[model samples]
Target: MTTYYTEDHEWILVEGDQATIGISAYAAEQLGDVVFVEVPDVGTAFGQGEDMAVVESVKAASDVYAPVSGEVVEANQELEAAPETVNEDPEGKGWFVKFTLKDPAELTRLMDATAYKAFCDNQ
Candidate 1:
């Protein structure tokens, strides 16, 4: 499935009814190589726009937000072993978590590919 992005720069690709979430290439590039990822524990509930993880890079730390209100279902444990994957493949291998979306309406707040491009251009 193709991914959608939030103005905050989080990305989520829905598969079936669940979605896998991550930071975008724009975010990873700005952060540089990832050093650590603080993924939410499984079962933690989050509201849309809530900060869920702390992505630590060589330069600084940034919060990764929840694009849709949901319960965290899975975290990418691979990030603990090789956080650099976020820089290597921010959209693919770098996915951060998976969640069961609680409110599908939250998706309406996200940006589509074209709109995201405009948002990035303004930044």
Candidate 2:
């Protein structure tokens, strides 16, 4: 499966009906050493582009959005213990949550890695 990224700096990789979500590496770099992550409770629902969590860094607080409408199935409780993982590895160990996708077609609204890189460049 491929990953899709948003203008809000969120990234998602959809595999089957589930998607793993997180802030982009660029966003983590800008946030400057993540300190805490305020996340939604598992089983809560959010719409596409909805604000589901807030990631706080030494520099600022950034919102984490739902790449597609879905119910949050799992969260990274590890982040509450060590949010710095976000800054250390935005794509891997840093992933914030997993959700059951609402509409798989909404995945088309996002940019692929190549497009995400261009979007970052334009910003």
Candidate 3:
């Protein structure tokens, strides 16, 4: 699997044409104690950079954007019951959605782990 990061602090873990989407640990930390998450339903399609989900925390409510165009295949329902999972494991079990990539080429526009770290460092 190849992982890509967006400037907005989202991450996409791509394995073949399937991708898992989530906020980075940096984003979870910034959000401060996630309380709720609204994930797109399966079959919902999103264009690159469009709002695909919403995350709310003690500090604020934030939109989680689609890093690339895709159709949602799964939404993490565990989040509805234990939203704090986002704080505990932002990139693992905390993932918001799974998608079937619409265009693999769109991934070329995202940052790799190294670039994303540097991008966060400057923020």
State each model's CA lDDT, in order: 0.89, 0.90, 0.97
Best by lDDT: 3
Pairs of residues at least 3 apart in sequence or in different chains that clash in candidate 2: none
Q: Which window of 10 residues has the lowest lDDT sum in candidate 1?
A: 101-110
Q: What are the runs in model 3 whose C-alpha is more than 4 Å off?
A: none
Tens-digit lDDT track for model 2 on 22-121? 9999999888878899888999999998899999977677788888899889999999998999989999989989999989999888999999999999
Better of 1 and 2 by lDDT: 2
**Residue 44 lDDT in candidate 2:** 96
Write the residue-wise lDDT of candidate 1 on 3-46 in tens digits: 78998899999775699999999989989878998888999999
TM-score of model 2 vs. true structure: 0.96
For model 1, the superposed segments whose C-alpha errors exceed 4 Å read none
RMSD of each: 1.1, 0.9, 0.5
Candidate order by TM-score, highest to lowest? 3, 2, 1
| Reference-based lDDT, residue 102, model 2 | 88
